[model samples]
Target: MHTLSNAPLRTVVWSTGGVGSIAIDAIARRPDLELAGVWVHSPEKVGRDAGELAGGEPLGVTATDDADALIALQPDCVVYAASGPDRDGGAVPDYLRLLAAGINVVSTSSTSLVYPPAYYSPDWRDQLQEAATSGLASFYASGIFPGFGSDQLALLLTTQSKKIDVITVTEIALNDHYPVADVMMDGMGFGRPLDFEPMLKTPGFIEMAWKAPIHLIADGLGVEVTEVRGTLDRRVTHRDIEVAFGTIPAGTCGAVRTRAAGVVNGREAVVVEHIIRMARDVGPDWPTSEFDATYRVDVSGDPDIHCAMNLGAAEGHGAGRAAMAATAMRVVNAVPYVVAAPAGLLSSLDMPNTLPRYAFE
Candidate 1:
């Protein structure tokens, strides 16, 4: 394990998108963390100040498109927030590169990596483990759903139960405010035809994206998951609705509900369900929440436990920005623990409770 000193840990922001921008702001404002560098994928973002791109202020830290330069800086950690659904090809190499360069990584890019061994093949898992060992660095993957909503938060709530039967974690969110076009449209099938089969609906897709959370919960509770299953359904909009990404025409696909079920002993033991909508009225009959973005965990056992968490727009931020900020903070707050952890793939279960720093001030 790497020992961290009392001084601030040097850090780098790996992208400038929604979540990445929020990470930059959080790192710059925290007293225990120093923003060392900013990496951008676009040519237009190159040479721009990181502070300007993050919070409209100048921090004198310029953004660069050079990945090698940032790796050479040898920062204590990297907060990777790049967006790409197809993890097998897009973000895996990037993570391997950083870990091989001896930089500890905490990321929200790949959801399956939240509990890598759950869904990844032996070859891939061994490769990442080997990289971490070779470079003497730690790697952790997390986010709102796979990170906290399902695995961490849900498992925490289960501690009060006297007997365990089934655990369900749900994400009910209106995605209209979310501005990621590729994710909202191509990845999720929102704003597309009802008949169109999005990548999310493909066979084994939901199981792969959510298998980590299911496995994490099962492992934490001392149970084994026998099999994993998935189901997906969509709803159409009744009228045109304007969203942050674009307009969704009437009769188009506006909502999607997906479920990844972990069966144990011939019964559904742990389930992760996503209720995503582009309009509020699209899925009225489905599980609805008062908050724009909410997560609910229901435990069926001797001592039944139910908990719901609501996340919405702050005083000056939009709903989308609020969600991004929360997601970024989930990983950003884990930096210290990750930096101090042993050189290997770390999960929320492996680290202590990661709370916010300087949040009250």
Candidate 2:
């Protein structure tokens, strides 16, 4: 067992995009973590200070496009937050290489790795396991929805249930402000023709993307999921709406509703649902929250339970920046526990409770 020590853990920020930029900021600010090095994929980012890339003051640590050079720094942990929807295939090999080099990793790139064995092939699972064992490192994958919003928070809420019957976790977001063009336009079908099929509607894609959270909840409840199923639907915009990313023309795909359910016996006992909209009016009939970004949990049992969490900006941060910070902090906060954990692919169930490093003044 690894013991807590006075020396800060040497850490590397694997990418300087979206969540990766947030990780760099958090690591540089935290007193318990040392910003060792940064690995960047873009040559333009090469030689830039990690702090500048993260939109903060210079931290003296230069970002490198060379993966091998960052690995040579011998970082204790790597926060892998590379863009996943389009770059997942390459991200896996990067993770494997990092783990093999004795560097623990916490990532938001591959949601499947939240509970890897549930979605990954046995060969892939064994390879990751073997690599971790050989290098004495650990790898944990998580994000906002799959990490805390659905699996972890739902499980934590269920502890209050006298006799739990069903648990449903939902994420309702007005995604117009989110600035990922590929994910918004191509990946999710937003701003696309109504007849055009997005990747989310592809058969088995929803199940593959969400099975980890379903399995995680089921395992926590000590129930065997008989099967996993999913449904997808979309709504068109009635009028043109301008968003931070781009414009959504009238009659284009503007909102999406998807549900992935895990069946235990004959009932959909565990469920993860998403109601994502580019504009508020696009899906008036669908589920929504008062806040722009909200996570909700509804548990049906002897005494019914309902919980809603709103995520937004701090005093100086914008809503978009706060959301990204929350996502990055989820994995960043887990670093201490992950480093202290035994070498392996750890799920939420395996790790100890992770709290913020500097919550109180």
Candidate 3:
């Protein structure tokens, strides 16, 4: 068993993008962690200081596009927050490289890794396991939705239940202010024609993308999900809508509703639903969040319960900013636990309670 150390862990920020920048700032604020290096994908970001890139004061560490150079630094953990739309083509290789180099990794890149056992590809899991074992390093993946809201929060609430007939975890977000064009437009099929299918709606893709949490919740509750099923619903705008990334032309896709349901005994015992809108009015009939971003969990059982987790930033900041920071901080805060974990892919259940260490301010 690995023991926690008093000395601050040398941490590296893998990207300076939305989530990665937040990780950089949050890492610097933690006393148990020290900002050591940063790896950037954009050439423009190269040679820039991580702190400044993250909207904070300079921290003396410069960002670079060199992944090998950052790995050579031998930091305790790498906050891998690079985009994961291409999970296998991109994120998996980077993860393998880091794990094989004896560098522990905590990532928001791959939501599928939140529960490694349920990852769609058994071959990939085998490879990751081999790499981690070879280097004696640990790896973990998480974020606000799949990480905390969907799995952790839902499972935590089941503790008070006398019987759990069904547990539904829902994520409702207004992404009008999110600035990632590729993710917002191409990946999610937003601003596309009604007949045009997005990657998310492709057969079995939703299950692959979201089944990790369903399996995790089932395992935690000591139950089994017989089969995983998915559903997708999309809506188009009647008028052009302006957003942080770009404008969504009238009659283009503007909102989406997707769900991954875990069936047990012919019933949807566990379900994860994502309802996202470019404009608030697009999905008026669908579920809405009290805040711009909200995660709601409803448990139907002996004692029915409902809980809402609202995330919001200050006046100048948008809801996406708060959700991004929350996502980044989830993995950033797990660094200590990841560093002290056994050499392998770890889920939340494998680690002890991770508190916001030194976050008393």
Q: After superposition, which runs of candidate 3 have C-alpha atoms over 4 Å from their true positions? A: 1-3, 313-317
Error of 3 at 262 (Å): 0.9
Task: Tell me each candidate's TM-score.
Answer: 0.96, 0.95, 0.96
Query: Would you list the rank order by lDDT, best first?
Result: 3, 1, 2
Clashing pairs in 3: none
Model 1 worst lDDT window (10 residues): 313-322
- Candidate 1 overall Cα lDDT vs. reference? 0.87
Root-mean-square deviation per candidate: 1.7, 2.0, 1.6
Q: Indicate the worst ten consecutive residues by lDDT in candidate 3.
A: 313-322
lDDT of 3 by residue, 172-286 (tens): 9988877878777777889999788778878998888889999999999988999999999999899999898889999999999999999998998999999999987897899
Model 2 error, position 335 (Å): 0.8
lDDT (C-alpha, whole model) for all candidates: 0.87, 0.85, 0.88
* Tens-digit lDDT track of model 1 for 1-361: 4788988999999889889999998898899999999999889999999999886699999999898999999999999888765655677687789888889999988778888669567677788889998989999888888779988889888879899788999998876777778888889998898888889987898888788999999889988898889999999999998998889999899889999999988999899999998767898999986667788999999799999988875322355566677899999999998999999998888989888889876
**Regions more than 4 Å wrong, model 1:** 313-318
Better of 1 and 2 by lDDT: 1
Clashing pairs in 1: none
- Return the top candidate by lDDT: 3
Clashing pairs in 2: none
